[model samples]
Target: MRFSQILRFHLSNNKWTAKQQYVPKHNPVLEEDIKRLQDFLMSKSNIVVLTGAGISTESGIPDYRSEGVGLYARTNHKPIQHMEFVRFANVRQRYWARNFVGWPSFSATEPNHTHHAVARFEREGRIQSVVTQNVDRLHTKAGSKNVIELHGSGYVVKCLSCEYRIDRHEFQDILNSLNPEFRDAPDMIRPDGDVEIPADYVANFRIPPCPECNGHLKPEIVFFGDNVPKSRVEQIAKMIYNSDGLLVLGSSLLVFSGYRMVLQTKDLNLPVAIVNIGETRADHLADLKLSAKCGDVLPKLFNFKK
Candidate 1:
């Protein structure tokens, strides 16, 4: 099956089923569980939400870390680490080339139901803050006020040498001017906003430099090997410390940075509830684990007046 078809299939059918009596498959939010979660939220003055790539997958953004759906998987290559991309000039060229090709579709993506639901929760004061591992700025676009992007966003690319920032659109224009022959080239676009191109062609592609400083430009994100900024980490820690409880959405919590936050919530004796599809690393830590689609559960759960 094609990538788009596979995505549609997962979206249409993915859900959770109940094994116990008096429980429903489509409705993973049991009345008892809802009461527990609702009471938890009501008692708390502040509630924190930790989100991941899964939250944005519904908006047609792909999870670049997953087995079959990620950029590395599509190319049958190991993921390019942060250090490698930064150190190797050819790697940087390929990286930018892919970014140039896939920029349009990624830039065009809009926020989905889950994003809107979370944003609404924040707006209504149901959620105090959101810490996300995703690079997509859908949370902010959906109207969320206090969002901490653990990984950087795709919309902004920065120069490695001069630290100059350029919008993705502006960088695309530069790529077009430099490589006119590749303007109409066809390639498979990956979920992480990267394109699959021929290795030889990628090796020869010319990447643009910072117009003012002649520095190397790169996507502003926490690459695979890069650590999340300490200041951002401290900020999230403070948010978690201040919040009554932590609510996790659509994340597996596979990475240590996110998982550590969930662990901290548990250590603080705060309730941690999770809404996700598969088994997460923090499943054991979750006070209530709702194994269901976020789009289905979040709206009802965070709809304060209801």
Candidate 2:
């Protein structure tokens, strides 16, 4: 695919789906396949690892599309829409209620073996950079120096109408002060740090406005019905252009934001390797596809201590 074709494809498929199911299955991988993955990394000088929610699942965060234990598999909960979050007061109230209830546990999650091994890969100069769809910031927490958060970070809260910015922790404190009596425990934390709480518990929940401008506040993330910023896309494109290959870690590439990076690599005739638990959208396009957990396989490849 050419640049024009890539752009067209992105435009066509950028819409969000309510639910996508993948069988919770891991295929047997041979020793020779492991060797092939090692050789694949050895053959590339500049490699970019594109990661997704699967990488953080081991850290105890649930992704939306992973097989049985994923959020969609266990619940019929729908993600908050970009427009609704921006336009509706009630939606923002419910969202903040869930976030407030779930933030403590979600923020406490630590980086797992996969994150540490990827950081090791960067330290050893085997990989040049990481482009992750995960907003959890685990890659950076694991000591990866050059990381691009393709979908943005949930740890940041920005004013929708102005230049006010606040750390999520600070915002959490504000939420605590405002809703002192709204103590509700979440059933479970979703991938986006949201949880399921009673509707009545959310009715009186208060969400603060931007202190600097009284503007609407939202997390700095690309929501389900939103597009990734054009500048961010161009930045990743430049990284891929300078790289020898793309190594997808833990991502199924169901979302085009990450999948398009694989497509762009393919268009450049670069080798693409996938290390994931199950099937991926780009399995047919990969030079080698390893159906294994990232935490399990990455430690073996990098010889990192768990």
Which candidate ranks first by lDDT, i.e. highest? 2
* Model 2 spans > 4 angstroms off: 1-24, 27-29, 184-194
Error of model 2, residue 304, in angstroms: 2.9
In model 2, pairs of residues that clash are none
Model 2 C-alpha lDDT per residue in residues 1-306, reported as the tens digit of each score:
554355335434741211112224566566677788888988876999999888887776778876676778777867889999988999898888887887876687678888999999999999999999999989989999999999999999999999888899999999989987854353333333345566777897888888888889999989989999999999999999999999998888999899999999999999999988878999999988899877657887744675
Checking candidate 1 for backbone clashes, the offending pairs are: none
lDDT of 1 by residue, 1-306 (tens): 767566435434642211011111234456666566667776765899999877776676656554465444645556558999888898888777777776776676677777888888787788899898988788888888898888888889998788689888887888888887785544354433346787876876788778879987888888889999899899888888888899998788888999999988988899898887667899988888877667666666655322
Which 10 residues in a row give candidate 2 its minimum summed lDDT?
Answer: 15-24
**lDDT on C-alpha atoms for all candidate structures:** 0.75, 0.82
C-alpha RMSD (angstroms) for model 1: 6.0
TM-scores vs. true structure, each candidate = 0.83, 0.88
Model 1 spans with C-alpha error above 4 angstroms? 1-36, 65-77, 186-194, 302-306
